[model samples]
Target: MRSAPGEFEIIRDYFADAPIGEGVVLGVGDDCALLQPPAGALLATSVDTLVADRHFPASADPAAIAARALRVNLSDLAAMNAQPLWFTLALTLPHSDAAWLQKFADGLLQTAKAYGVSLVGGDTTCGPLSITIQVTGSSVKPLRRDGARIGDAVYVSGELGAAAAALPVVLGQKLAGEPDRDAAERAYYFPEPQLATAAAIGDIASSALDISDGLLADLGHICAASGVSADIDLHALPVAPLARQLAGERALELAASGGDDYQLCFTVPQEQVATLEKLGLDAVCIGTIVEGQGEVHAWLDGERWFPEAAGYEHF
Candidate 1:
């Protein structure tokens, strides 16, 4: 009888042939990847781990899970106004399933190619199923959390709350029509990284971050880092339509406090607002920075509003 494929054999078969991009000196099959980062550009790197049943449903499609893992990590690069360059995937598998690994690798490499990032190197280990991806990119004039100033305009790229609303459908806890189910799956599995918008606003935005932990919660990070506060107009939010369909009256609250949209939330100084407008980006100003310590205040129809949940907490 044939034995199951070992760790190195699995890597050699499924992940060895990833597309090699410009800066890759040595890619897979080596102990470590040798990369040549672009001169005169700062390197921005971020890592994220998605555990089965926590970040994603354990029984979901392997390909979809792989795509989600890589895409979300790439979102971190976008938030820093970085150009996609390279990434590493550390995969922990309960067992060496050849079919599952092939599907996962296919999804991961396809998404990497689409985003112009190359897979460098990573490790495979035996454990509970989890995927950890670390992405590195080059950035010129990178946006940061501490760059927001009082009087700056707060903005977000694209709509929000769709992914959070899709949770029920994704987990199979709720049934939906075909259209809603497809929309929910798309939002949950294949969130866009907003790299183009981030690049467009890189020079203009004073502060920026990707909204992984709800708009209000992530915006508070910028506030805390910049020693400022924000005043958000609830009516100005561009809530996703899918959120309204799934979450109903709670759509607004979900948009404010639900996580996993992977959209960019940024601040622009008053002087650069005109410049930003000229760029014709798909971004909307939702609020303004105010002189206060790290607090975010929301007003709905001129009345103070608060969300029931702050955001996702790991602990």
Candidate 2:
């Protein structure tokens, strides 16, 4: 059996080579990371925590855990059309397993490289396994939920609910069988944040949010913030193919209520629809904003449909 390494040894061996650029004066090894901000853009920051049992299976691959923890925060940056510059990680482990740490660092560093972000600084400690990531980004005219108008069209990026569909499989509650099963498990393990397309959409999307929670629930947040109502065409939701195959009759419900999709949901004004289309974003028009209080009227084939569960709950 491999021996557990000490904290500094783990840092030196695993996290010491974190990529640095974009005004990062110091990273990882320093007492505090020093950063120089770029001009002409506003800074955007987001933080996310992933707990072992609540977020992922306790026995999940350490690399997958690290990826999920960081990607979720990056999703927040994508929602605001922000580009990530730097990030810090705080990891708590039951034991300092060197192999696990190495896998985790590989995942973190690779994702950081793909997203053009540097690992600035962080701390490690012993405890129940959990990961927290703080991401720093920049944006010009950050998308705000309150910016939607009554005439705006609501849209979403990518297909939804595959990750949620894999939950039963992840927990081993369902027997793994089928092509869809593999697809769903892949989505659950490595959810791709819509960072690239988000930048492409840019200010064309007036109000935007990442669908970390279920589509309906996260859309409701936008409605509440904008003090507007919406008419969501349930059939228009771009449900993932695997989600439909796996969920069967519950596909729509899962798409509306299943969290962790991490797709971008946004609205564009009637006048700006052409501009948004010109950007060639992989988004679908799912609903329309209207003149009313924050009431979301979900419709399916000309009739209203409401589900029992809304989405994942923080409390």
Local accuracy of candidate 2 as per-residue lDDT tens digits, 80-156: 88888999888888987888889989988888888789988887778899888999999987888898889899999
Number of the top-ranking candidate, with TM-score as the measure: 1
Task: Give me the candidate number with maximum lDDT.
Answer: 1
Off by over 4 Å in 2: 1-10, 176-181
Worst 10 residues of 1 by lDDT: 1-10
lDDT of 2 at 60: 83
The Cα error of candidate 1 at residue 42, in Å, is 0.6
lDDT of 1 at 33: 83
TM-score per model over all chains: 0.96, 0.94
RMSD of 1: 2.9
Q: Rate the local accuracy (lDDT) of all candidates.
A: 0.91, 0.84
